[model samples]
Target chain A: MRSRGAGTRTQLTKLEELLRELRVEEVMTRRLVSVSGDFTMAQVKELLRKHRISGVPVLEGEALVGVVSIEDVTRALEQGEMGAKVRDRMSREVITVFADEPAVEAVKRFAHTKVGRLPVLDRGGKVVGILTPGDPVGRAFRVMDLRYREQEQQRWQQKGLGLEDLLGEGASLVLRFRVQGEDFAGAGKASVQAKRVLGRLGLDPGAVRRATIAAYEAEMNLIIHTRGGELTLEATPHSVVVEAVDKGPGIVDVEQALQPGFSTAPEWVCEMGFGAGMGLNNIQSCADEFEIESEVGRGTRVRAVVHLSQSGRKDRLNR
Target chain B: MRLQDIKVQLEAEQVAGSPRPELEIKEACAADLMSDVLASARPGSLLLTGLTHPQAVRVAALASLAAVVFVQGKEPLRDTLVAAEESGLPLFVTQLSLFESCGRLYQAGLRG
Candidate 1:
């Protein structure tokens, strides 16, 4: 049980000495793709497709204003809660590294920090490029480990692909995908795909972001916190709806369920950098119209709606 | 007013998640949950809450709050207090209900 057959898959963490040898200037991927805070969501989507990056730094005339990730873009297309403003969902006060420092330091920072990207700067603080520790070779090995084992595969199992499984034939534009609940490896995939759907349909980015956050939270709720629920993505010309119904033991208190800090997830969730108890509240925060009904003995139903035509909203930045 | 002034109004105990004593204060907000407080609290404000965990401290850091007051004489967990200590934030403890504590601070010029 201790090994769980994870022997060959385990890769050692980088030592501090290795980190100390890493200089920010050495490993950074040069030629950053940046967007102004005023850039349209359509333009940002194009940038992601072109650069093949998960995020882009948002510049307010070179003050290093904020950053837009694939997650932000997805949220915009899904619910449009954050509006067309890039500053709304962008992470301000981005973590950074100096070129004179060791390259391994970037890896250490990435492992420790909540954010995924670090902008590299030289002595004078001019932007050099970026560094992302994504798709580590070790990870590819771990993913390959799960490829053959049926017992291990059960954790990430899916009944089928596409929305028809969760919602009947009446559901339109059925968006379907599997939840990597146990691994937490690809939890947001479903929501991100749904966001692209909205963008292609010319839905507002503001609405897209909101709906995506709510939907992602719900999907994560199913994957991480509950016993795993199914997702139903149904959209019409005027509104987008996400329905997540999980067969967990069901919520204990609807009132407390609506309140924040009301998480029942184990402590390791926090250790692994997931489950901040923001799941339910974040869902409530973004959706234009939200409804939830759960029975203690059975399951839970969360329905969220986002309109198609809402305009810009003032997005806040946190230092 | 500065943090030293607000120290006089607290219940004279160090609750677990309460920030340190030296950090400066500019305003105050009293809430138990993480979401609305994150959405509403201003920068450099003092936060009063019943939540005694690291997430609260994380929000406090993200919002750039100066101090966190634990009302009802509640003790913050070790992790929360440790985060506050690491952040060098001021921690204050008060033996009062959420309503009365907020009311007393409002009377003392700690505007919402």
Candidate 2:
């Protein structure tokens, strides 16, 4: 990625537009701190405390070796695991995001891939910066943007830009929102609330439907994973759009994450009422169009589109 | 027979519904989880269960369930029955257990 120090200024497109405007050369954290895969568990544990970071990127020469987080170290500690090295605990598979791409692509990547943090790379494919969902602004923007997007959709429907106007014509809308990751009890709350608002306003059932499904998944991602993120709902008279973004850990694998019954959540996530492993698959099953992007140390974003004119019946109420 | 008749037959009470003293009884099925009901409950089917919650009625509406009988002396709170009333789905609270509810209905000529 170019350095964030030298990038063109553009109109704020919410967080997503800013990402699109980003070139890999810009915004990459140049300072590099990492550990080798050969570092022992004992060494890694000491390094974690010394670095004051939750995890460290693993490097084999100039290549990404793996990521050794405190979580892994803790697991090892619990088992009294020693002798083995960072490679043993480090997550070998990584999710990477290109520096030249827009940030909006991170949502689907996270939800569908289920990895935390994405590694941004330059044109030559060298690691540049990290996108962790833990960033303060990143978390705040995710929550606020999701709220604003839901509210914006409500506003648009109020102005009579709902089904009656769009079913037969061409119209579009963009929404911004964030999914609060910390509230497990509030899973699917946004969908229920949005459903009520749409019902009261007499909005298009289709638009409300797509939004509700999208909202449920987006909300669940934050709740189950506890990684704050953003969700946007955009609508055209002929279609609807949803984008869920998370700066949390990037997904490990897009394909595997989207598969039904494939969950990386521990028993606690299930016991605490967090995961059914249905989040990513459900989103894909509902959206007419889907796209995802992620990096190992950075974050992930998802974009989904549904064409209104050609969109078939997605009767979510019956779902 | 009318739902009101079945309620009286089983000594059931109206917790939140309008009692639909006039609504008709059709068929019967029993399940507890919402997901199961969504996948298997049929239209116009009279549902028997011990589950109580808003989501129960929500799934009922989605599946077009005709009536719900809370068996084993189970009953929904005041607000839940009101939602059922608003949706126009007949709801009954029975003292009989789930199995007994099914048995009595079957003996009484309720099919399916």
Root-mean-square deviation of each candidate, in angstroms?
22.9, 24.0
- What DockQ number belongs to candidate 1? 0.04
lDDT of 2 by residue, A253-274 (tens): 8788877667777675565323
- Choose the strongest candidate by TM-score: 2
**Fnat values, candidates in order:** 0.04, 0.00
Per-residue lDDT of model 1, residues B1-112, tens digit only = 6565676766444433222345556678888755556556766788888876665665565455667877787776677666654444556667788888777778887798
Q: Candidate 2: where is the Cα deviation over 4 Å? A: A1-177, A200-207, A266-274, A307-319, B1-112
Can you give the DockQ of every candidate in the order shown? 0.04, 0.02
lDDT of 1: 0.64
Candidate 1, A201-303: lDDT as tens digits: 4444456556665677777678776677788766654457878987767888989877767777777655544456777777777667889999886989999
Clashes per candidate (backbone, < 3 Å): 27, 61
**Candidate 2 chain B lDDT trough over 10 residues, lowest sum:** B13-22
- In terms of lDDT, the poorest run of 10 residues in model 2 chain A is A4-13
Superposed by TM-score, candidate 2 places the C-alpha of residue A32 at a distance from the truth, in angstroms, of 67
Residue A276 displacement (Å), model 2: 3.0
Chain A alone, TM-score for each of the models? Answer: 0.45, 0.43
